[model samples]
Target: MQTQIKKWGNSAVVRLPATMLAQLNLSVGSPVDLKTEGDRLVIEPSLNREYKLSDLLEGITPDNLHESIDWGEAVGREVAA
Candidate 1:
């Protein structure tokens, strides 16, 4: 597919078709990496991965559990539980 570069404020922008974005699993506000290789512009998705809280908690076990530290008596109007 051929696309033309258009002026967007002070930057040049190229609009990708919805079909192309859907095929690449990209959406609005998705992060992408852009580079130039031998006069060719390469656009690719960023490598950053999003992690879920439940998935992260699954890695913790009794073997690697840590004990809470004991802080001394609180000063300066601190509430005691």
Candidate 2:
């Protein structure tokens, strides 16, 4: 994806096509993180970053006993089953 960097008003910007943006799961105001992963520059939607469920649940207590199942696999099984 060789995109030309062009001048945007006062600063330079790369125009991401709508298709490309959507493929990358990006939207007009979606947050993104920029970092050099290994040797390549990686640009991805910020929300795609992985966070532990425990981190998100923080102080919340599970009301039921079945909530302890690993959600990713559980969802996969539920969908596949």
Q: lDDT by residue for model 2 over 1-81, one digit each (tens)?
A: 798879988998777799998887778988877789799877767765687988977756566324555546454445754
The lDDT values for all models are 0.94, 0.75
Candidate 1 lDDT tens digits, 1-81: 999999999999999999999999999898999999999999999998899999989999999888989888788678756
- On TM-score, the candidate that comes out on top is 1
Tell me which residue pairs clash in candidate 2.
Answer: none
Question: All candidates' TM-scores?
Answer: 0.59, 0.45
Task: Spell out the clash pairs found in candidate 1.
Answer: none
